[model samples]
Target: MLFLVLLGFPVFILCYMLAAPVFGYLGDRYNRKIILGAGIFFWSGVTLSSSFISELYYWIFFLSRGLVGIGTASYSTIAPTIIADLFEEGKRTTMLSVFYIFIPVGSGLGYVLAAGMAGLTGDWHWAFRVSYSLSPMGLSHSLWSFVWSSLGLTAMAFVTGALGMWVPLFLYRAQLAQGTVSPCLQETCNSSNSLIFGGITVGTGMLGVIAGAEAARRLRKINNKADPLICATSMFISALCLYVALMVILIAFGELFLSVNWAVVTDILLYVVTPRRQSTAIALQILVSHLLGDAGSPYLIGITKNDCSPQWSFRSMQYSFVVCAFVGVFGGAFFLLTSLYIEEDRKEAEQTSPSSLNTSSSSLKEAIFRV
Candidate 1:
């Protein structure tokens, strides 16, 4: 258990980070659809490969897990960019919201599927095998003493990867030219002035709720239209309400906290990324969330377990999920508010500086607003 905990999460994060850039680059340089298709194909293949190991060969398992991370990361990065490419920003969040509704359901089904497969075969190994085999068809296959999903996914990967190579060149040319149209010309978030201002602002804002409130108040004073305070306040209130709802549901319905969080977070991400990147955005969101969120959580739990009683350590770690749930609720509300503020700010600026709108890239702007 310790070995699995230690090895699993870091590899998940490392591979996630490594692959995200590749996907991002691919989305930028080529057609988003092809990148997304390839990502799906490769991710499924690696996921199936993971089930093939008979022994706890840590390195081999690590490598296979890494491959899974790579495929997933690539998909996330590319998918979001694709959505951004196709959709207008105003409707992106609603579209993403619809897309994200699947995560919780999918995760829950995964657990059931794993358990059912294990029961049918009377061997844990068969669970992974069944997972791999069933994925290509998106179906639950017949019972078997031994089955391997890795082979099926690998086959799919080969086919998808080959087909992806043929995606149109015109799309790349169009995106490249689009980058120069107007929004891309706006100052990058990474510029020197932005770095200093953004860093300090974000840091101070995150330090305490009061700081964020104060900042919001100042913005509202200046613009009379900015509602940062209301956004922050709404988030706090909504989080409290959700906490009560969660407690009720957990007690009454016996719902798992992690499963619920997975559902909530996924929906939030889809809502935010959809208008900007559609299905491709899902890949990028997964990469970032896994690379930083779950990766860090597991590592922290591992460290705690090492120093303390394992039972207490695990319990404490589980408690963190409750905190995370509230954070997610709050974070979502805050982002909505921030987006409103940004839109208002942009509209005001656009009235005076119409040319600035054309100089910016929608992709870049969407990323900023979403973040």
Candidate 2:
């Protein structure tokens, strides 16, 4: 149970990582203001409620933390994209830098908020309650794209979500099948799969991000649609590696390919969609990714395993994981399709983005004055 408490941070991260993409998809398709506002509202409510949890229900604390991550994900994925639309080239980069400055400011303010609240109220729970009361959160302005989503990245999300949660367990089940490990009904089973997998995830995540970014940077000098091409290529290779992930090294390679597109996909949406719609496109991409990917993949895999064969756990999971390979292929194919339309879309975006922003900015004022 203490270990579970220790896992709170990791749980928050995994939830944030998984939820960010889903929220990204949402940002692109829905009312940006509502989603952003709802996320902040949800975050504050959950955090405040969590403070009321009793000592006996520690798991709820973890659950609340995870929910908070999901709520924050909306802002994380949507805010910058909206900023991208609001500013022109000369000021865009500067605005983004300024926006990120809030990270440190918020972090620092949080410590003060918590400390001050706890000291004044004489209880940690009041810290959360007071902090929630003080938060001012919401957004105004709304607009609405599908081209940015070939659902390829969502496929990657599915693959990673399932693998991240289940690979170690799958390996342990494999060992059990091979009779290399004993399964005790009432005793804790021993295994190093989790630790080993964690190391690989950390190492390959860094390497993949760097490799993808560098490759895309070099390739874009010649190809305007380089982002999707790189994404497609990586997904294809990742699919192949994960299809044969029975080998330990193949898992590492699969993760490497999967990690390469984190930033690249957002880049694609930024250029493909018009400025007024960029926020919606980016947020929707995130929504679809999490909606189809990490948010459900584990359960999908687990249920398939159970339904396939109750008695043969290892074989069932083995077959279920194969779904990820096919999804990866589908994801790669989506990226390929994205490559076809990206150039045209980007051209359209460049031509209209400025005018679109100008029109949108005047819309609310015009309506108000007309009233």
TM-scores, each model vs. reference: 0.52, 0.65
Candidate 1 lDDT by residue in tens digits, 1-371: 22553566568668876777666655655767776787778877777777777555867878887787787676656544444355543344333333333333343344455445545675656656766776542011210100111111122122111111111111222223345323343222112222332232233222322333333335545664333233334344434543553333221111212112222222233323322232333444444444444555433322323255434433443343345345535444534444443443334433333234445666578889999
Write candidate 2's Cα lDDT for 1-371 as tens digits.
22443456456656876787677667767777788789888998898898898657878888987998888787877877776667654344345535543432343344455445545665657756777887765111211113434388789878977886677677767777777667662112222565456667766666676677667767878987788889999999998998887534248888888878765666666666665566545555666677767777877787744334323887778788889988999988888888877777666676576776678779978999999
Which of the numbered candidates is closest to the native, going by highest TM-score? 2
Residue 175 accuracy (lDDT) in model 2: 71
Give each model's whole-structure lDDT.
0.41, 0.69
